[model samples]
Target: MDVLIVGAGPTGLTLGIDLARRGVEALVVERAGELFPGSRGKGIQPRTQEVFDDLGVLDAVLAASGPYPHRMIWKEGERLGEEPLFEAAAPDEGAPYTEPRMIPQWRTQEILYARLVELGGRVAFGRGVTGLTQDADGVCVEFADGTTVRARYVVAADGGRSVVRRALGVGMTGEAVDPAPFVVADVRVRGLDRNHWHAFPQDDGSALALCPLAGTDEFQLAARLPQGAAPDLSLDGVRKLVAAYSHLGAEDVTQMRWASDFRPRAALADRFRAGRVFLAGDAAHVHSPAGGQGLNTSVQDAYNLGWKLGAVLRDGARQTLLGTYEEERRANAGAMLELSTGVHRGAVRRGGATVQLGLGYRESSLSVETRTAPDGLRAGDRAPDGTVAGVRLFDAFRGPHWTLLGAATAPAAGIRALPSAPGSYGPGVFLVRPDGYVGWAGETADGLGAYLARVGL
Candidate 1:
């Protein structure tokens, strides 16, 4: 295999789909027997929705998800007023999706896994990694069941306690984002209507929230436990928790599908790559779940690495292209870590920056701008949605290929060209990377070939 992705979470599965569509030989291995059965990472930010759009899972996600509802505060069994649960900028056509969608993390994975299979990808479940070794040529991965797989590159998406990251001797440095223990569960309840995210704030500085899960009869129960108290993850224990936090009786909680407990913390790996191996998702960074940044950031990590891996393996690009993955993602992950920690501590709001649309690789080594004083978006900015010559920008840039908007009129070699530039992009030929960021820009096609050659076009 060209690549071995350990951990079949959103990150690994997404990388699998991207690599599969690019015709790269990659395999995803998961230690878990089945997909995760929790609704922990439920909020899908707008930028991630754009990623899902290109990956062809946006429609499924939208169908299964609903808009975030207002939070209904409760005190002494009496309903207080309502407040916004999630912060979002005012709606605009800056992109197809401006607001985040509410879908269970499990459903998102299922949709991604389905798309991966549709693209002829394969995932091996119950293949736990016991150990591994790497060389200049490739990486040798050992599994718990006395089996080994070798690939040119390996991605560690197995999550925060990643065995692959440990084997590579990578250290994660972090501090607790919140001192209180937290418990999240998915349960079926009878007393709560599926309209508002019901919240019961306690005077003791702890809180409980039960939000109706989109496209399902379940509710996601998240509670901020008192400091230093251990959480009980049992179904009965969850029922008792509901009774203690709300007006609903313990018997009102009918069924518990899944549950987990954790202490919120923010951590980042010392590095994203070591030799032929790379760390992605929680393996590379772990953060507070306050602003729903953890899973979204993880998915973007895979998106950033997917096309680069394709360029190297399928298109014969230089190995140096792979090095940029660590350079770009490590910095972005660090920034997101700070943002998540801020949100956890009430230092930041859940809107604006939390959406992640403003993020780009402005300082990346690959983002070269030959044009002087280019108007509108600069090199390495996200190519926003627009239309030119009756052609939608996103539609033109959809597939596993680079798109050139502006100056160059004709498609050349492997690059897709749209000569008529949208007025918003200023006046230059912008080469959009497969991951949707403008990699190179120029007043004309000058130096375009040089940039392409550098990226192994």
Candidate 2:
């Protein structure tokens, strides 16, 4: 195989979809016998929505999700007040999705898996990667069942406790964002309105939140335990905890679908790439669920690495192009780690920064900013969506090809050129990368040819 993704979570499945669409030979291997059945990492950021748009899964995702509801604060069976959990922002031409959408991580994974299969990709479950060894040319992965698979490259998307990352001896440096334990579960409940996320704050500095998960009949119950307290994962335990934290009785919780617990933490892998082996998603970075950055950042990591891998393995681009993936994504992941930590500590609110639309690769080696006086959008900035010459900019950038926007006339080269949408992008040639960032920008195509040649366009 060209690529072997070692987990079937959002990261691996998304990478599989991207590779499949690019006609790259890739396989996704899952240790579990089935897809994850939890509602962890439930918030989908606006930037990730754009990614789904490109991968052709946005409609399904939208159908399976709903907008984040206002948080309803309660105390002693009395409704205190309703507050917006996230700061609201209006959608503009530049950014289409201005608010976070609520969809369980499992549903998102299913959507990506379906899209991958639609693109002729395959995922093998019950095949856990025990270890991996890489040479100058490729990687050999050994499974727990004594089976082996070889691939030109391997990605470790096996999550925070990733066995692949352990085999690679990559160290993750991090600290606990919260010392208190947290328990989250999907449960069928009563005595709560489905329109708001119900939160009950305790005087002991602990809290409980029961959020109505959109597009499903279940509500996600989250509770912060006291220091040194063990999380109860049983259905009876969930019921008791609900009674202890809120006004509802233990009988109010009808059923518990799934449950897991963890202390909030923020960690990043020392390196994303180790020779032919690469780490993506939770394997590379683990974040506090605050601000909903973990899964969004993970999915974007797959997006950033996917096209570059496709360029090298499928399009015959130089192998050196792959190095930029680590250089670009590591820094972004670090920033997101800090942001998530802040949100966990209640130092930052969920708003524009949490949206992730402002993220880009301005300082990367691949970002070629030819124009010294560029104004609005520059190299390493995300290409915005807008109508240009009766064609949407995102529509032009949907496929696995580079796009040249704001050009009055098409360059002699085979690059896609869209009429200048001066209102949104200003007047300049914006070379949008396949991953939706501007790789090069200039007054015209004066230096576009060199940039294209460098990226194998």
Candidate 3:
């Protein structure tokens, strides 16, 4: 096989879909028997929404999810007031979606799996890896089921506690964002209205909330417990938890769907790439669930690597193109980790940085700026959406191909070339990478061919 992905979560599946559509033979394997059933990692940032749009799952995501609801604060049984759950962002011509959308992790995986399968991608479940070794040619992964799979490259998307990461002796350094234990669960409760999240803040520094899950009848119940406390995920324990926090009685709690306990922590892998195996998503970095950066950052990690991998394996690009994956994503992941820790500590507000639309790779080696006096857009910035020469930039950039926002005056590369660029993109010749970042910019298409050669076209 060309590639072997070591998990079937959003990161692995998104990479699977991208590689599949690019005609790269890749396999996504999962140790679990089924998709994750929890409503964890629910917030879909605006940047990730754009990724889903390009991946053809945005419409279904919009169909299955809704905007975050206002929070309804309560004390003793009385309603205090209502406030926005996150900082508000307005839609602009460049960005159509600004606010975060709510969708359970389970639903997101289901949608991604469907898209991967539609692209003829295959995922083998119940395949747990025992260890893996890489040679110059490929990586041979040994599974606990007494089987081995070899691929040109292997990706560790198994999770933060990645078996692949550990097997390779890669060290992860992190700190506990909060010393207190936290419980996150999805349950069916009768007393809470589904319109607003009900928050009950106690004086002892402990807190509890029941936020209704959008497009579903269940509400996600979250609470902070004392240090070293074992989280009780049982139906009876949840019933007691809600009753103790708010005015609701234990009888109001009906069913317990899915539950997990976590100590909010921030960790980063020592390195993202070790030989032929690359670490992505939770395997590379772990973030506090605040500001919803963990999942969004992870998904983008896959998006960034998927294209580079496709270029090397399918488009005959140099293998050196793969090195930029770690160069770009590791720094971005480190920044997001700090943002998440700040949000977890209430030092930062949600909405702007949390939306993840402003992130880019301006400092990457792949970015080239030939213009001495660049205007609004530059190399390594995210290509904004707008109409250029009667062409929609996002629509033109919605596939596994590069885009050229300049005059197609002569025999140019096979990239999709627009006659002109939108005002938002400035009046510069631009070469948009397959992952939607401006790779090269100049006053004219002077060094476009040289840059394309590095992209392995």
Candidate 4:
């Protein structure tokens, strides 16, 4: 295998699909016999959707989830409140997705897994990594079945307690926001309003956030139990929590589909790579699931690293390209950690979606330095989406890429023109990456030269 991915979760599967699409041979090893079927994270950001578009999996995901409306958040179990978290007004009309869709984590895994298989990569389930040894040449991975495989690179997309990360002796240090454990239940609650999220504030210093599952009247509710509260994983517990929180005297809420317990912890590995072993997804960072950004961030990490690795392996680019994976993604993960932490804290203080997704990495090597004001947004930063761009294409749906909008013809190279007005967005700028990421931005004539000179492009 050219690359061995330790886990087949969203990040690993996504990376596998991306690598396969780019003609890179990769293998995904998962411990479970099949994908976990449940809702973990609900909201997929516009930026991440752009990556899916680039990988040609967006349509599949959309097909799997048909006609799901944007999630609506509520306070105290009521609907008609202030604007929802994703429905708030932004400067750009098309900046965010026309509608932010919701899908369970397991379904997301299935979609990615199917795509990976289609791309000539397959997942070896019931195989878990137990040992790993890496050197300058390659890495030797040992599965629990006493099987060994050699690969040039290894990515640990496993969850927080990653065996590959532990074998590499990478120390993950961070604080646990909630010392006590909380219960996460994904059940189909009947008699609940089809619209609006329901929250019940407990007197014992705990609360719940209910999110609706599209097309189904049932809702997915996340509630924090009292510290050290160990409720049995039964229908009784689900019914008890719903009634206790909502305090609805007369509603028959049954059908407990799935239930699990999760401890909220915040941690980030000191480094993302060691020799041939690379850490990604939860293996690299874990934080509270406040903004539903964990899986998306991990997938984005894979997205960022996949292309760079392909460039290095196929194009013989500098090995230093791999170094930027940690530099760029580590910083992005740190920002996500901070944002999630704030949102978690705000949940305890004031109940609402306080976390905003506006992280920008303008200071990265991948971004070209321009004359934009320091405080203003930059090319590498998360590009703002709006209607001013004249087309929904630049509206932040496809993630920020090299967008050159203007009338004047500037010499540009290594750029992909978008399906929008030529040079209307920026005359000289010719192209933007799928992520709305500007690979090289400037006049087509002199812009490519100036960009190539800056980053040796």
Span of 10 residues, lowest total lDDT, candidate 1: 406-415
Identify the runs in model 1 with alpha carbons over 4 angstroms from their true place.
Answer: 88-91, 408-412
lDDT by residue (tens digit), candidate 4, 49-107: 76677677787777655333334444455654433454344434334444446777777
Q: Which consecutive 10 residues in model 4 have the weakest lDDT in total?
A: 348-357
* Whole-model alpha-carbon lDDT for candidate 2: 0.91
**Whole-model lDDT per candidate:** 0.91, 0.91, 0.91, 0.69
* Predicted candidate 3 versus true structure: per-residue lDDT over 385-406, tens digit per residue: 9997777788999999888888
As for candidate 2, its clashing pairs are none
| Winner on lDDT (1 vs 4) | 1
Candidate 3 segments exceeding 4 Å error: 409-413
Taking all chains together, each candidate's TM-score versus the true structure is 0.98, 0.98, 0.98, 0.83
